[model samples]
Target: MNTTNSIQQALFHRFDREQWAELRQSVPLTLSETELVDLQGMNEQLSLAEVTDIYLPLSRLLNLIIDAKQQRSFVLNQFLDHKVDHSPYIISISGSVAVGKSTTARILQTLLQRWPQHPKVDLVTTDGFLYPLADLKRKGLMKRKGFPESYDKKMLSQFIADVKAGHDEVLAPLYSHVTYDRRHDEHQPIRQPDILILEGLNVLQTDADTLVESRKPFVSDFVDFSIYVDAEESLLKEWYMQRFLQFRQGAFANPKSYFNHYSKLTDAEANAIAANIWDTINGPNLKLNILPTRERADLILTKGANHLMDKVLLKK
Candidate 1:
C-alpha cells in the first residue's frame, strides 16, 4: 500500500452538482407542492428542481447504505448463532441556524420513507433537548441559548440511547418557538422508527477533550450516518437576519409571543437587533460549537448563496 495513496483515499470524494446529479436512480418525487411549501423555512430558498437533482440521489445513497448495514447485521447474527436486535438507523443533520438543515431533514424523511424498506422514518430536532427557558435564565445563559452549555447533554444522550436500544416508545419534550420555551404538556413520542432523522445545530459536536477516556457517549455516537450542511459565514448571517425579520412580521406579531416586542420595532430596530443577536450569539455558536464538526459528517452539502447545493463531499 503506497502511503500517499492511502492518505489521499482517507480524504473525501468531491462531486460537483452535475456529477452528484448523475447518482440519482429513478427515485420518484413523492412530496407534493403543498407539502414542499410547508417544509421550507421562512426566507429559505428551495425548489423542486434542486430536490430532484440533489436530494433524490442522496436519498438513494442512504437507502443503499441502510440495506447493507441490515445485511451485515443479519450475517453477524447468523455467525454468532444468536439473535441481536438491530437498532433504528439514525441519520443526523447539522449546520448553522439558517443553513437549511431543517428543510433537508424534512425532504430526506419524505424521500426515505418512500423507499420500500424504510417506511417509518421520523424527524426530531435537538431543540427539544435545550434546557427550558427558565433554566437558562436561572443559570445566566439566556444569551447563550443555542450554545452547548444551554442544552441538557446528559438527557439528550439518554434519549438517543433509549431509542437505539429499541425501546417500545420514547418521549421527547417539545419546545415552542412562539413562546421560546419548552412546552410543559406536550411531548413527541418515538415509537421505534426504522430510521430517525435528527436535525439540529450541534448534532455532530463531541466533547472538547476527545482524548479523554470515558464510557459516556455523545449524541453522534448513535448516528449511523450524518450530514453537515455548509455555506459561507456571511451568507448564513444574511439568511438568519432575513428569517428573523420574517418572524417579526408573523410569529412575533402574536400578542402572546415571547418576542412580541420585536413585532412593534421599526425596520431599523429589527435589523439592528437581528444583527446584534447573530453577532453576539448565533455567529459565535456556529464558529465555536458547530462548524468544527463539519469534517466529521459522512456527507457534506455545500450550499451557494442561492441555497442550491454547489458541491458535495462524501467521506471515502
Candidate 2:
C-alpha cells in the first residue's frame, strides 16, 4: 500500500443560493421559535435560516461520527487488552480571529442539542489557557497575547488528553477577553458529555517535543473531527475592523475595558487600530500558524466576503 499521485481530489461541495435553499427544504428544521431566538441571541450574525439549513445536516453527520468513534475506541481497547472507556467525542473548530469561530461553536451546540443522540454537547474555548495578565507582562508577552507561544501548551494538551481519557470531570482555566487576562483562579468544570466542542484560534497546534516523541499523540490526535473556517484575508480584515467597532460601542464602554481607549476613538481611528492589529498580529499568525493547519482538518468551511459558507471541502 504505497502512496500514489492518483490520490483523488478532496471534493468541495459548492452550494449556490438556490442549492442552499433546496437543501434547507430537504432537511427541514425541527426547532421551535424560542430556540431559534436563543440561537440568534448568541450569534447575531447567524440567522435561523442558516442554522436550519447548513448546521442541521452537519450535526446529523457529526452524531454518526460520534457513535462510530465510540465503537472504534472500544475495538482499540480490546486490541490493547485494556479496559474500554468511552470518552466524549471531541471535535475542534479552529480559524483566524473574527472568522466566526464563536458563532460556529454556538451553532454546533444548538444543533447538536436538538439531536437525541448527542443532546449533551459541551463547548470549550482555549481563551482560558492563556497566561495570566501578570504572567504575560512578566514574560514580556502581554502585547503578543494571541500568539501561539503565549498559551500553556502543556496544560491545554493535558486537558484534551484527560477529556479523551474519559475523565469524569475536567476543569479548564477561564479567561476574560474584556479584561485581557487569564482567570486562573476561576476553574470551569466540565463533566463528560456526548460531545465536547473545543473552539479557538489555535487548538490545532502541538508541542515540537510531542512531535519528536512518536508515542506522544498530538492534541489533534484526540479530535475525531475538526473544521477550519476559511475566509479571504482581505475580508477578514474588514470583519475584524467591524467587530472592533462594535466592541468599542459595547464592551469598551466599560471604564475597565482593556480597550477602553477604543471607546473614545473616532470611527476612523478605531478602524485604523483594527487594521493595524490585523496587519501586525492576526494576519501573520494566520499565514504562519493557522493556515498551515487547514490540511489537518477533516472539513474546511470556505466562506465568502460576507462570511457565509460558500463551499464545504471534505477530506476523503
Q: Which candidate is the best by TM-score?
A: 1
Put down candidate 1 lDDT per residue, 169-251, tens digits, no spaces: 99988889989998887999999898999999888977653556666899988899999999999999999988888999999
- What does the lDDT read for residue 198 in candidate 1? 94
Task: State the local distance difference test value for candidate 1.
Answer: 0.89
Total backbone collisions for each predicted model: 0, 0
Model 2, runs deviating above 4 Å: 1-28, 32-44, 71-84, 207-216
Please name the candidate that would achieve the greatest lDDT relative to the true structure: 1
The 10-residue segment with the lowest total lDDT in model 1: 3-12
The residue pairs in collision within model 2 are: none
- Report how far residue 268 has shifted in candidate 1, in Å: 1.0
Models 1 onward score TM values of: 0.94, 0.86
